[model samples]
Target: MRKTLCDTLGIEHPIVGFTPSEHVAAAISRAGGLGVLGCVRFNDPDELDGVLDWMDANTDGKPYGVDVVMPAKVPTEGAAVDLEQLIPPEHREFVRRTLDELGVPELPEGEQKQDGVLGWLHSVARSHVDVALRHPVRLIANALGSPPVDVIERAHGHGLLVAALAGKAEHAVRHVDKGVDIVVAQGHEAGGHTGEIATMVLVPEIVDAVGDRVPVLAAGGIGSGRQVAAALALGASGAWMGSYWLTTTEYQQIPGNAATQQALLAAGSSDTVRTRIYTGKPARLLKTRWTDAWSAPGAPEPLPMPLQNVLVSEAHQRITRSADPTVVSMPVGQVVGRMNKVRPVADVMADLLAELDETIVKLSDLR
Candidate 1:
């Protein structure tokens, strides 16, 4: 797995783990793979700055990256109050009715409801970039698609490599054309916002389209060393894995996520469903009663991007607080099936490398 990506990113392996947990990200970097922290979860730049400060102190000086959500076409941007006002009454009623039907409880008396992710807005995402640039980040990845030209240029000016997630061959080409240094061909099986292309088909098509121009990382349904080897065989410089890290012990340490972890541990490969109910885009999420309710008759069409998220944000909180594993809303790939047991990030990374080596030897023997 010692591809040019390893040398470029200054890691021992070509595996790049995408995680939202700072501890998980640091652990991955310390274990020799580049860990890219998801930045959209941080609505406050100062908070993100403090977290990055912690990351800098930790990770043993190993390289790490940051992923930001910058939609190509900007969405409705405003204050939380203004955005709340934009949500239709019908949508609000739907959320309320659904929560009631699910028996989700209200927050504790003093607990204030958390707002939806503001990072979906371009302005907020740009602030993320501004904060990230001030850190020692080696790479900046856009979760939605190619970032703005000036943003890409600014990252380049800071001597950071820019990567964009692409779900199609054309999208990959466009990323390269827009001066993106890396293209992550994330398939439909991927979590969060995704397109209809499967990894097995999308990886090779993207590699053929832009592998010669820039390194392509294969994402979606990749959790083990065998999948990493397959990604390399398909011309990817590395495997970009997100879902596989969710069950790591580091992530398990996060507060109020035990129910979510239990749901992931109980899932199988066939248990996932791709639905627009998550983020108002086709995203693979764990099949649960929450997702099921969205498909029932008379379920209104999900609002686009930020608005839909805003509408359902508190509902998600209520469900999580309800501590019902069967009703928790989480964006996870089909790989969640394999995420059965919790292990240290170091152990997982070791297993991945060991499995990759064993797989490589087996493939070599076929000759």
Candidate 2:
């Protein structure tokens, strides 16, 4: 459906897809929606640059954005090696023992491991911002709270719109006050990091609070076209979708992702739990044995943000390399129950639009 958000971003649809794959991003843009590439995986500027280059070449002159986890709070200074030393021995032992008990094997040989630097750090995220600004990115979204004033000003100076995800009504107000062009009110049913409020309650609250100043995008448990229509009804100018793209064909085609896709397919809505086991932030993850182990008696408390992230970085590498679905930690939303099969991005969008039209017709008929 066409909305002010589409006109503001110069896109044909008011759908904004947040994904980590450049392929998925490009495909969404090519399908008339804006694709926001999640840059948390790219700790290296050069690697991020390469992905941006690919997106630029493949987007066919459509608009796209970049998302970075530039949290409002983080350690001011510390090397990865120094941060690694801060993780307690018991926490490390638990991760090691849990994987062992799950029978998850290690990598075969010569597979590259994820660097433990943890891109959520302020410095690394800023570096990503630097790289993104050099490209033709139309928008820059922050995964955490309102971006710093300077970052907002910087993006504005470059003639790019800035957006941020807020889980609370007050957070949306704060984001707009800080000059964010868009505020994504992501509820608890969302994938990854989330808040306590559900989408149904949070979206309208945020819209009522700041809809006059800026557009609000509805996120959390939004997968179907009906949900998109519902978001528009709640006063959101668009739907900011993340989890919907996880099972897309382009995502399943990524190397070392077969297990992830299978796990997501096998999971139901109740199969997920909100825990800080992965990123030290309360993110919704598939309730696997690895996550359950963290909740058992005598388990060490999870370290905050960067610390917990560093502690499990290596263990996550081993688990992924092993390709064991039982121990894999996949972040997804309750709407995951709707993600039953793999489809192409274009097909997903088309189905969503069809559903949206049908929903609107049904609502209109109710009168």
Candidate 3:
């Protein structure tokens, strides 16, 4: 309650709910926490505008943030990609053959009309950032790495806070030097694209590395109030959470689609692996038939972001909509193991805050 983050963000609770679903975003903010809408899933700025407009209408004046996938390190812009270029014929053939053998047919166009290309690269994400800032988004967070200098400058120009995730101490320094308002020490256990350091080790290292230049939000494998308290103890201002929200009632996921996501966390750590089957980036996902097929010794390696991502987007989208347990594999982290049940988003936030209060009280009562 007393942390600078809560004060700075003007929220009743320090809990930050990260979800891409606009309804989930509004629900979390209405529940007294900040809701962050993940924008990497959007194909273009227009799609982002639609979501932001809906969020603006639903959030009842509560503040929320937007997340973009601006990787700090990327191949030269436009050097390789002509977004207009379709997937390679060979790769496209492979997907079609696999689907045919599996009897998965393309849905009738009567399904939702898809927006433009996916936004997982620096160039496309900048456009997303522009759309997000033009709206009332209170914060801008970069999911991949340090926020770009121009991104940070633009966020500050619009009077918004900017945060970036780092998987190492060195990345934390890069974020600080670029004027990031918050540094999320994201461990390898986080969902989606993550670097290779464990959160327990990375959080303290990054906090120390930054040396109070910016606040740190400890992430990766953090789900419970005890974990949040630990992050604060590790010198972070708070915890930045993702996986914990994936199984909530408001998830865009179909009801039964959560099993695999849940199992990734419940099973051994080996249950998960960094593969690009879903997004083409080295995102940490549960080892599913989908991922295993892509990573098998003989299979072609997953492509880079956006390219690899679009390859599987149709399947991921259709399955999530179908809510068919047999055909779906949701993206999640090792923390999904802790996401044991489907609960209300508000209830989840309340439990976290109550647990945090209990943690603080218990610590004070000691001795």
Runs of candidate 2 with Cα error greater than 4 angstroms are 108-112
Distance from true position, residue 60, model 3, in Å? 2.9
Q: lDDT-based ranking, best first? A: 1, 2, 3
Error of 1 at 178 (Å): 1.0
- Separate clash counts for every candidate: 0, 0, 2
Model 1: how far is 191 from its true place, Å? Answer: 1.3
Model 1, poorest ten-residue lDDT window?
1-10
- Positional deviation of 53 in candidate 2, in angstroms? 0.2
Candidate 1 clashes between residue pairs 3 or more apart in a chain or in different chains? none
Candidate 1 stretches with Cα past 4 Å from truth are none
Judged by lDDT, which candidate is best?
1
Per-residue error at 187 for model 1, in Å? Answer: 1.0
Task: Estimate, for each residue in 1-367, the C-alpha lDDT of model 1 and write its tens digit.
Answer: 2467888898999989999999999999999999999998788999999999999999999999999999887888898889999888998998899988988988889899988988889989999999999999999999997899999999999999999999989988988999999999999888877889899999999999985788899999899999999999988899999999999999977887899999999999987888877677778889999999998899999998888888888998889889999998999998998999999999999999999999999999999
Error of 2 at 238 (Å): 0.7
Q: Candidate 1: deviation at residue 259, Å?
A: 0.6
lDDT of 1: 0.91
